[model samples]
Target: METGVHPARQPGCHPAHNPRGKPKRPTGRTDGPSRKIEVRALAEELGATLIRAVRRDADDELASVGTGHGPVTISWYAFALEYLDMRWPQIAAKTRNETNAALCAITQVMLRDVRGRPNDELLRRALRDWAFVLPRPEPHAAPPDVRLALRWVARTSRPLTDLMDPAVMRAVMQALRLKQDGTVAAPETQRHKRMTFVNAVRYAIEQGMLDSDPIANINWRIAKTAKRVDPRVVANPAQVRSLLCAVSYVGSYRRARGRRLVGLFAGMYYAGLRPEEAVAVTLPDCVLPAEGWGRVILHVTRTQAGKKWTDTGQLHDERGLKGRPPGETRPVPLPPGLVAIWRESIQTFGTASDGRLFFNERGGILAFSTYDTVWHEARQLGLPSDLVNTPLAARPYDLRHSALSTWLNAGVDPAEVAERAGNSVEVLMTKYAKCLYGRAAIANHRIQALLDEYD
Candidate 1:
């Protein structure tokens, strides 16, 4: 039924005129699809006065029922039912009154049938059974219907209304985990679903329905080591050098699969650039000098979130680096060799239509197929079997870890290294501390030299 305020009495009735009165109990029993009683009876039962509905704003057909708690009006409900009767394809205007009467049955449900069920369980059931599923058949979706279902479910879910509480939010969050199809099956998957569930719970609490927010208590702790796979396994320095030396800047061999792949990994390793960030580099972004090292300034990168699924193989939107508050840039210095590779790459494969450093033959964003194909060729040619089997050097970014660690082991100061690599000292130390094992004896010898001075 159409639901909205009635014209004659949009503000409802005043409590002073109604006073408190006990409702009249139903004396008769009728079966088969419960029907609404006369407005007088309902008004009396609800301790309200029946206001009649009228054709215009001041008309008389509209009715208002009064009560000590608030005014309970029936005119709008009757009008709404009439409106629904007309709108239904199968119902005739002659049946409008009856349909209106039936629509009013909802009052009984509101006042009696569902008054005390646990809100959370009800919301969970609604989400599981209907919410997204039921709306797919419709042309457009009504978020409110879904929200109301969720709200009602929350109201009925029991003593669990607060969102800030860790346990409560954890439970709610657990409900939104992404299923295999990429929609919210539970609370984790993509960031949006997690945030949505958290916000919904927070909304319930803010509305004064719950006492606390359960999510506030969650501890966002890191439970695993952050090291990239070792690059030595993928390609050692000597192997990398050999791979780069084999490619030329011209002809079919220049366009041969491994040239770009070699340049890609070498750039990632020596420049310490993330794949998305590295892919955004253009001919203009590369600054090379004739005799020494140069720099590659990464002005854009692609990151995905609610707008795109990670499994879709979509490109990250062009944007500044992660954690760089908008407007800032991340610049990585290029070793002389990598600069040489990029110069050759540009001469071989012309810049993408948009001046991007990399693209497919059609000038579209480079696809994973191209990347993987190039990588496989470079892998077989540039890496040994034992190192290839190990995890440390399994992927492109691992080369970055290798480069960063190599610099650190060469005795680069942590602060200088971190700044050059677009990382903080804390991250630098955490990720490559183990790589420093090879330099431990050298450090120990220095410590001994200091001790000798004391002696």
Candidate 2:
């Protein structure tokens, strides 16, 4: 009789089948060939049915899910893209970039652990440089390898439902706390990432993807961070004057490049203006009297956050003074020394095309790199070797700290100092508390006077 097994299923297909003869059965089996064939077909049919049922169930689960704003059937990658689209237009460029970074960090752990994984470094680059910057026009096409890696990630990323798991949330927090080298991130960086994650989770809740923020349920401890200014970095009055004099000597061949910044640096030392605010100061903003104290009305500040993080694609972003609302101005009184310095600078160098008191040779806004280089050289020239290695006025920003500390130590009211420095009184007292030298001595003197009366 002819067998039901096809000729294609002969000896070569299985060791049990003989090419020259009928197929052989196991020695212990008594079942007939037809019965075995029926059983095999039935098993195959059941497997197919089971697979189809599983796929159907998955589809149903996805369909039933909804984010408060819309459906939650999308993968994490898709959801992140949608979130960026909604937020891109409403936030500042720096904020957008920071959010992108945080999301990229979160995405690192929001993937399924699948086979054929890409190199970690390549995958990280793809997420940070391409996937996260969703709204920005890509400057160049990704390489073939990067494209392939990103495609793999997109395909294997977990769905939004997976984020509800406490384990997944833990993974995200852990990822944010680590650097690329697997070391702990800096405290400030960790804090920023945590804030970003918290905001994103809150957005998820709003959309109805999550019922609540998982971060709130977890107890996470960040490394201790120092918020106070170090007194060691503060420069004394004599040292500041010496540094200013040295600034005029830097790049002496470049038509007094250093000299142009002397007044700018002096403004930071005298008026407690941030470097950005001082750079944004204009002729109209200043009311420099002939001999007495003058005033500077600071309504705006120009901060450099790089072209990529600025909407105008310029190096600096002009915004309202830090922590202040637009159109609000802070009037900082300039000491007589700064008034003289400002008047002399205007008389000698005139103003930029826009009336900015400070500018480069082309009458453009001063480049941060140029001023930083000038400061480095001046520090070397002005500070003695021992002090040079120390933290005394180590950075341009230190000048502002030094100025604020000087004001506090001079017994200036905390509220008045806060107004001049564009900071809250609490911040002034907390951050500069350590920098207020001689306060302990004064307190001790008062205590001694009380003791003498008792004696």
Candidate 3:
């Protein structure tokens, strides 16, 4: 028997429409998979009229055998908008962008059918740039092509109920694992996207749409992200000094392009400060003196989260320290050399309008590109040709890594290192475990000294 929607009125009709008063209930088990044609699917086949038929006939067996109807629908696209609106105020700008990126990728799979779908590129832009963001543009006000793409997504987005199907979740997994171009995303990227999806579905469960987290049921394993810092990027103190010296030679003397960042990068090397943390340092945060050592009371990170994503309307987001709550502070000891650099930076370049120690000549937050370009040039000038092409201090962040590793190799207590570096001990040990081996020669020397005394 060919089992599909029928062209003519089927056997399982109620008394209202059929000349036959009411058809007898079908004999087979109603719970079986073959028994139901979901009213939405039936509506697709028979047009809107089938919905009225499903609603009018409340007979469970007959309706189950013909059109399975339950309730009115909320498309996933609209629900996702609502989900985002609820979450907007609470999260930081970076987190908001990250969540949106995850959801934007998942949107490709959440769509119902591709019938009459607009261009893939157009659809993606409409969703990512507008629909996923908190304040969506009015449908009419959107660009003509964007309006069409948004409308298509609105029309064809699958209902929240459809997630009960395991196959739907498998598609979501594929979306998380792959980029829009169908290439594999990085392992950390995959993990981050999955985390966002898990949170979204948890919201669905809270709304009573899902019985449990579908992610809990799925067995998909993403690739493991490396926690350890790459040893190739680590540079010794002497190399770092040479790189800092080289930064001075970049750009004209008046421009002072590379000169502005020497103190900032040195903070990363000597204090194990993240670039963002270094950027946020102010006069109040520093305890520089004509002394042996100083301390920087770190409290915040000023990193770019883009104007589109942030509530502040500024391109840079002034956010609390990573892994620490707002208003909490970390105090890092600064060597006398770094203290002199700080003093000089304050006296020569002066502070930004906000009192931050480092800023562009225009008195704006330093653009990442300026520092990155300067650092690349500095590497070329300062390092030998063999090392310039290598991974050694390739990123300015690697200076912080060098600081942490140097501290670890110097036999500093791991707990103290973790506290100074603003990391948990477990994480610090895991990340710098390979770098810790450099201290073995010193340990051997001490052991040899003891053995010689015994001899």
- Candidate 3 per-residue lDDT, tens place, 1-455, comes to 78786745565454656576866656764654454666557657887677656434422221122111245555666667767877888888988888898888877789877687887788788888877876665555778778666666766778766776789988888889988788999999898888888888888778766667777667899999999999989999999999999998888889999888889999999999999898889998789999799999999999888887888778889899999999999999999999999898888898988889999888988778878999999999999998999999999999999999999998899999999999999999999888876677877999999999989
**Which sections of candidate 1 miss by over 4 Å?**
1-209, 215-235, 242-255, 304-314, 448-455
Candidate order (lDDT): 3, 2, 1
Return the number of clashes found in candidate 3.
0
lDDT per prediction? 0.52, 0.83, 0.83
Q: Give the TM-score of candidate 2.
A: 0.81
Residue 270 in candidate 1, Cα distance off native in Å:
1.9
By summed lDDT, the worst window of 10 consecutive residues in model 1 runs over: 59-68
In angstroms, the error of model 2 at 223 is: 2.2
Query: lDDT by residue for model 1 over 52-111, one digit each (tens)?
Result: 221222222222211212232232222222333233334222222223222222211222
> What would the TM-score be for candidate 1 when compared with the true structure?
0.56
